[model samples]
Target: NSGYQQQPRQQAPQQFNNQNRIQSMNQFDLIPMSYAELFPALIEKYLVQTRASPPVLAKLPW
Candidate 1:
């Protein structure tokens, strides 16, 4: 039996370039930060402000 030939992949015209991607990112004024650096600060800023009334006793595995 003969196998079907694979088709060539096409790159979309709206593909992102570095400057465009960076420009899009800049719209958020976001700079990449290490998870180690951002996580603690984020947790501190958000978790400290959070009040969990009748806090969760346990989470389901699912």
Candidate 2:
């Protein structure tokens, strides 16, 4: 056959998983946005949701 085939004697090096690499990226929470930057409905919904959430003094895990 003229088709190329891998040599059984050769071994490919293992590669690191992308999931681990992506997770190692810097963590950022809650992108900044003003009411003017958001749709009117979205702004109103976010305000209502935030108001409804209980106030707590707990640190979030990154």
Name the candidate that leads on lDDT: 1
In terms of lDDT, the poorest run of 10 residues in model 2 is 22-31
lDDT of 2 by residue, 1-62 (tens): 33333322433455478555322333344324543444465767775443466777589765
Model 2: which residue pairs collide?
none
Clashes, model 1: 0
Q: Ten consecutive residues with minimal summed lDDT in candidate 1?
A: 22-31
lDDT, each prediction: 0.52, 0.47
